[model samples]
Target: MDQTTTTTAKKVLCIEDEHFIGELYARALTKGGYEVKVVIDGSEGLKEARTNQYDIILLDLMVPNVTGMEILKQLRDPSQPALKAKIIITTNLEQKEETRTAIEQQADGYLIKAEVTPKQLVGILDTLN
Candidate 1:
């Protein structure tokens, strides 16, 4: 008789363009018991998401090459929700339409970057469930 055990870390994928902000988040989340993968470019970010499984996705609403909304749509597509992961969109822009649009696309949560700190951001992940 053998007892088997496996350890899996919570994985968080961060799709953000700002170098300082992205690095700030990766470091903060990494300290909060998550395995963090940060991608700065929109196209590369999409590729990374497709190739990985993440418990949560922290995305910037404004990214080049592939807008965050496009990424959200791709993730939540009914044809392939098998790969769908919990998404949280963060942005400096605070338009009601953007919030409504993000909710329509299935973002688990939305945060205004100007109003959040790295610590608060990490704390927010605890509410994802």
Candidate 2:
């Protein structure tokens, strides 16, 4: 008799323009038993997020082509199909008080890039559920 248990790894999409930060997140999340896909631009990130295939999405505010703020708005729009993935804002840039409040209200989580370590990021993901 053989007893084997197979658990699917949680899928994580990391949208960060900083190559180093993206890589760091990919490595940490992978090590934490998640399948991670890192995209360096907001255009690609928005495209991927629209698929609604991931369980978690780590988004950065500033990126090429499109901004993360726009992506979040689109995802949260009632006109579009709802997304199952939780969107977490990961950014170093500071926004206005009102803007920050608005974003925090929409996002599942928010973290400062300079304050959070890659390992801490993985831990944060674990707590999201």
Candidate 3:
């Protein structure tokens, strides 16, 4: 395979509250060749989600100022272009109800923080339609 082939990199936006997790995820996505941006709070995350174009979104369930559910709710509005992006939930919370909520909000996938690594997440993105 020619390493120089032109493959348009995908854009990814990660919404996370924890400092370490944000850096970890961003670094991983960057290494995976995606243009990745990290926002620490749901409000700021929501703002970025509204103002930008992304191929996918990684949303943490719990955050300050706003929760992931709130962000998902706002993004689901038909007027937002980002709503078309595949939304992936990343959270330590693995409750069935939370997963159901994420699904209802149109999430493409859900990842339990403790069970997933950056490499694995990138692999998931590779399998997307």
Model 1 whole-model lDDT (C-alpha atoms): 0.84
Clashes of each: 0, 0, 0
Q: What is the TM-score of each predicted model, taking all chains together?
A: 0.86, 0.94, 0.86
Cα lDDT tens digits for candidate 2, 74-93: 88898888889999999998
Candidate 2: segments with Cα more than 4 A from true spot: none
Model 1 poorest ten-residue lDDT run: 95-104
lDDT of 2: 0.91
Top lDDT prediction, candidate number: 2
lDDT tens string, model 3, 27-122?
Answer: 988998889998998899998888888889999989889988778778886675546688988888756786586566577788888898888888
Which candidate has the top score in TM-score?
Answer: 2
Q: What root-mean-square deviation over C-alphas does model 3 reach?
A: 2.8
lDDT of 1 by residue, 10-125 (tens): 79899999989999998988888789998888888888888888888888978889988888778777787467578888889765786576565687888888899998998988
lDDT of candidate 2 at residue 116, scale 0 to 100: 90
Look at candidate 3 and give me any clashing residue pairs.
none
lDDT of each: 0.84, 0.91, 0.85
RMSD of 1: 2.8
